[model samples]
Target: MAKRAPGLGAVQETMLITLHARARCGDEAAARLVEAIDYDFAPMQRNAGATELFHVLRCAALDEWTRQFLAECPHGTVVELGAGLSTRADRLDNGTAHWCYVDLPDATELRRALLPDGERRRTITGSVLEDGWADAVAADPGPYLFLAEGVLVYLEPAGVRRALTTVATRFPGCRVALDTHGEWIVKRSRGPLTRMAADLVWACEDPKALQDWDLGLTLRESWPLSRPDWVVRRALPRHTRLTLAAVNAFVPRRMTNSRVNLYSVDATG
Candidate 1:
């Protein structure tokens, strides 16, 4: 096992939950990292069934979106905000695109120790609320794709607006892919097995509300967890697919309102 590093904050530690899920789903890189880490994954492992499936499905949707962006802009830059032990760069490298992973200092420290950085791949240590990191990302090629995956929900509403506004202003015409929790989901996410110590703070009932914020964002697509796009649905196991179908048929929409959203940054922002 690798040497244990200093403890991560409550929110940062949650990355291990997604990491564990990816490992359980047969990701060789994730599995290797899981074996190398010294932390006790027992708590995260206990919630493995549906939670793991949902996590992977969400990742699949984002991967497909990223692939689409790379197809159009092969030399474009991809920046993952609040990236935590994410194997996305490894999984989606197209040889020519630049990849930058940004997160808190300690999380970046741990990630750098475990993941290799190359001429095209690098890590930036900073929070999304800061402006310094944007300059480094802007220095890369154009037509950027910024992914905030499972990061922003922990922030207060004001922070979310500020972060998105910064991205809109700095990288106009770029694409941003992020996940949001509805008010209902945010309320329930505080359950014992769900979020542990990091409670979700922002609650967006509809992604359209983001457009109303005057942040120069135009929602292109939003996929609810219960109803992922065909690409993500077909890739799921039969049992998982059946379960999602049942949820779509029976579960209240409010309960499953969390979504993966894609937005286009207005060029005139």
Candidate 2:
């Protein structure tokens, strides 16, 4: 599909679907699941090339992490922050859990093309920074995993804080897993390498900035979600590892987060 008209800036949307298309294709069930969802135009293709590889790698990591979470947590809810045209539900559908697609209204419009309105799997068409959307999700036990794959940097730093604060409040004791960029992105802004790495986004020098907003999230793990095996297996085997590493080099090296350190009487605490 063509990219969403410029201003809507569906860069996250495009990246997710391309990741869905390329990464989810790993298994037949996943491929069928992806084929089942309709993709927004151009969100993936418009930015395909090297940058898209990061999208693919991240999607794979997300899929693996989701699988891990479900196996570990009981009937957990998987909230895809800025879930644009991604068939993540297809790859990791376990019938018994809840899967919510979160994103802007326009991106959801593109998502509805394939996802359809449903029962177990549904859509929350709003920025994660907003409220109400959390209320829309069915309540589960403590420590919900709010995942933000490639959406945070595009948001104003404060917007990200608001989103985290909301999630931390709504789901007390919830742990979040997200990917973020490093200090170098904000500090060094020059050359094609910078352009290749930084294209319309912001990075954080310290991971704890989320806590500064009074959100009760704590850092869990911050390791590279790199997959040397998968990269080596790609058709262009020659450059896949090098390519993946080059992209990953820009990511903050640890699992940066703030946990539900202490819960106030209100979930918002």
Candidate 3:
């Protein structure tokens, strides 16, 4: 008898890539999940070290923002859009906060098998382009923090706008944390991503441009991945710190073009 690879699309399969990266970064739970899965992760090893560092820094920044939100609103609801094998809830559970992991049916099925729903946390099977998941999240408490992470770049510009607008319209006054790639990165990513059957369609030159959508979103903070805030910077290993410093000094645009952004949803909208 043999185990089977989970039936997931190319973009969904990328979750395993991030899972492997987290495992490489010494995430015990991610490591265990990697061993449990039967897929060939060889392709994911192309740039393993860089992938691990990139994911570590990205997750660290998002985790920091999540921690800050939880600190201010202990019982607020935290919704992770397109959450695929993400161990965020496990990492940032404040005991009282509600957690909702939303994703497509295939991804959600895999996640449900590994990460079971609990009293404080649960999973919803749906697309971010739709509004059904919003209703489920609305049932939870207020002061929501929606995390899109590495999810939106897969969608077209219109789809991205629709998704963000939906969040703003439904969960006003909420906060959203997401990442965006510049056209240069997106163009370069196409070739490699095509091999995995996934593509990066949405390219944002400036995260602040999102405010022009009239979705009631205000860009609260945006920073390049290579230069995270002091909290995230302090947690990095010495090697990673030095590497990022060098990258920041020489090829600044390489990392600066892609950023992690935090936006606040206005209540009036």
Candidate 4:
């Protein structure tokens, strides 16, 4: 069993929910690994109505995005920033794409133990705010898709901007997909798991505004977290659904809910 810190491990519990959700849906790989963990994730399901569904949807979106990349550029690189216990590389391996997992030392250590490296996949231990990690991925030639799943919110606005600019400068014409909370979500931003001590420091109401952070980048698309399938929607209260629909209709660009956003940056040459 992997040693775990009590409160600190709380943020990682989000990944556990993803694993459990996937496992129940007959993902053998996710199920096999999830069986080793000893944590009661039931509370997560009860408290967070659509947590599992959102993860499933996000994984599906990322899978398609990754497939599209591999189809175009077989030798393309994929970087998972703040990769906790995500088995995305294993799940979406295209046989030729190189994959890099970047995270803090402890998280990377855990990842190494759970999912050992292979010829095309490796782990880099570092903060996304730093310089060296970008260089680590730079070894692989052109066209990278950086996925920052549950990251970014923990960073201050300046740090987020710096990271984005650094990526654009380093990889040039790379694509980035990340999740961010809105102003309202940030105000009440306690992590979904009670034990997880996540202090979300930045909130962007408009993802398009991120373009101003760096000249090379432009927001490609944004998918609201609440916009799950009908099966998940039925779990939400009727009023909540109505309100979200109303918000979607009124301010299409405003991120009243958390969203996964994609950005494309031009080469800085």
TM-scores, one per candidate: 0.96, 0.68, 0.95, 0.82
Can you write out model 4's per-residue Cα lDDT over 124-165, one digit (the tens) per residue? 988888878987888876689988886777779888887787
Q: Candidate 4's error at 164, in angstroms?
A: 1.1
Error of 1 at 39 (Å): 0.9
Q: lDDT by residue for model 1 over 96-152, one digit each (tens)?
A: 999999999889888898897889988998888878899888878988999998899
- Per-residue alpha-carbon lDDT of candidate 2 for residues 22-111, written as tens digits (9 for 90 to 100): 743364543544545454434444545544454555566666667777777757788878876667777677877678888887777766
Consecutive 10-residue window with the lowest summed lDDT within model 1:
188-197
**Stretches of candidate 3 above 4 Å error?**
1-4, 190-194, 252-256
Q: Cα lDDT of all candidates, in order?
A: 0.86, 0.58, 0.86, 0.73
Which has the better TM-score: candidate 1, or candidate 2? 1
> How do the residues 195-243 of candidate 3 rate in per-residue lDDT, one tens digit apiece?
5778788999999999999999999999988788888898888988999
Better of 1 and 4 by TM-score: 1
